[model samples]
Target: MAKRIDVADLNIYYGETLAVQDVSMSIEPRSVTALIGPSGCGKSTFLRSLNRMHELIPKARVEGKVMVDGQDLYAPDVDPVAVRSQIGMVFQRPNPFPTMSIYDNVAAGIKLNAKRMRTSELDEIVERSLRQANLWDEVKDRLDKPGTGLSGGQQQRLCIARAIAVRPDVLLMDEPCSALDPISTQKIEDLITELKADYTIVIVTHNMQQAARVSDTTAFFNLRGIGQPGQLVEIGDTATIFSAPANKATEDYISGRFG
Candidate 1:
């Protein structure tokens, strides 16, 4: 099922410092939304807040409602763990478990979210998930090989396979292609385009071309002033933001005129 994310007057704080201010936007269901900005502009911070992952950091906190589907993720009695399970994340770097095999890495999510299953059922899930991630043909012959043994691209694919194995409604990717070569980056990029059919994807990217290539919509973030918090400068369809942004700040940033 496709799920929409609505951020209502969101603010984020790290201890005493306000990192992001009054950001609000709606993420369309089963579509790709790219968050783009310069370093320290709060794109990554805002993305983390979407899944409540920011709360995992010491002294990190957020205010306002982040609705996934129709439920408030931070509401009292709502399990953050359950919320996270429904929304999976892929990091800036490929982070598959070093000691685990490729097959084990993908199966890990299923095992955590679900109880024991028949061996046949487990095999099928692993196969399907890896294939969906476009890693099956590459890693199938080496299913028992350690995940770390694969190339950076393959390891990244394994991580993606792991994320989707649990059938998450939203997938948050934090620069998943930053560490890879162009060919490898293209694979992950293509996979992101394809996966939007079943998952709402939010990406935090420093690469504007990447955002343009994969996103249905784009949000440009910029810091308000020296030492001040970051804010959303503009949000619109990918074509509109790239070609004729309503905000001068967004237009300047995309055109390399300013940050």
Candidate 2:
């Protein structure tokens, strides 16, 4: 099931330096929310914090709350690994396990989490996940092939299959289509539209057109100057953010006037 996310007074820090400051937003369940900003604006940093992936960095930490279904994800005693299981992530590049077969790639997460599923059940899950990712029909006969043997787009969809195989409540994609060709990008966009019916999705994109095309809601992030922490400039329905943002900075950035 999809889950709603509430971020309150969230600040992200690397060592002693703050990267994102006081960002608070509510992400609706079963919807796609796109985060857009120029390079170095902390858009990806903020996305990583949602799943506690940010803390993987040395000396990194987050302040305030990231609540999913009313549970604070960062509260004491909450396990980061468990939090990640509920929220799956895809990266900027398609990174299939180079040595693993396509079938094994999709089954990896499920096997890691469930540890005791029968072979038949694992096969069923791999097929279901590949179908959900829209790649089953294309690769059904090649299940034993190396995942990296596919084209760039197919590899990305394979990664998506892997992500959804675990049945996560939310999916976080950080520039998921950035490395793909135009055709591949479109395929991923269409898949995102379909998946939002079952998973709350948060995507960070530098491509404004892609953001406008795939997202239901949009959040614009910006920084004051060099060394300044990134802040949430404005957020609203996608149409409003693209056409008539209330904040001048948002309008300016969206209009291509400045970053």
Candidate 3:
């Protein structure tokens, strides 16, 4: 089972304007929790806030608490780097460090951020990371090759290898399959199911069928105003949400009445 992420009354703001409002949901561990909604619904924004990435923006602020396991991520003394190390993220696009070799790309997090490990330890970590990402069989012989030499799907998998190299407790993916072809997308979706046995996964996707296919729980968010925050419309098991959503807005959104 995946660990649960408990969010309470979470609100996100950029400068003086709010982007997401009063969102509360528990993300189950060892399973995929997907965030789905129309564009600009703040799914990506909310995903970033979980690891405090929103703090990178000049005036961005996150109110309320996000608890991973049993600890609050935004506690005054909490280190954002520490939070990120525990909660790894993959963007909508594959972002492997193009200049680095596949082996180095997978180990970058450990090499730069992780302070103490012997060379032997790093070798083991890199190998195991690739295995966990399901790319080892294909990339083992090409470890020295540049990350950019791989196909787009392989590049995305390389990114996943990097994220898992650090052994994160949670992995957040923002439309990870959006840039890939159907075969590549299926590869990633299968990887999600496989990875969940060891890591909790949260995904943001516009494809409802994708959500139903890979997610155990789904959360819906919708735009509010020109500048107001996007709000959580509904959240439940994939079966319940698709078969019989309780909220009218959810019904409308799922039924294709409006985005």
Candidate closest to the true structure, highest lDDT = 2
TM-scores, all candidates, are 0.98, 0.99, 0.96
Of models 1 and 2, which has the larger lDDT?
Answer: 2
**lDDT of residue 236 for candidate 1:** 92
**Each model's backbone clash number:** 0, 0, 5
TM accuracy, model 2: 0.99
**Model 2 lDDT per residue over 201-252, tens place:** 9999999999999999999999978889999999999998999999998988
lDDT of 2 at 136: 99
Clashing pairs in 1: none
- lDDT by residue for model 1 (1-259), tens: 7699999999999999999999999999989999998789899899989888999999999999899888999999899988888899999999999889999999998888867899999999999999999999888899999999999998998999999988899999999999999999999999999999999999988888999999999999999998999999889999999999998888889998876
- Please give, for residues 1-259, the per-residue lDDT of candidate 3 as tens digits: 2467999999999998889999998988898999988889899999999988999999999999999888999999999998898899999999999889999999999977856988898989999988888899999998999999998898999999999888899999999999999999999999999999998899999988899999999899988766667999999999999999998888898889988
> What CA RMSD would you report for each candidate?
0.9, 0.7, 1.3
Model 1 stretches with alpha carbons more than 4 Å out: none
Candidate 3 global CA lDDT score: 0.91
- Please rank every candidate by TM-score, starting with the best: 2, 1, 3
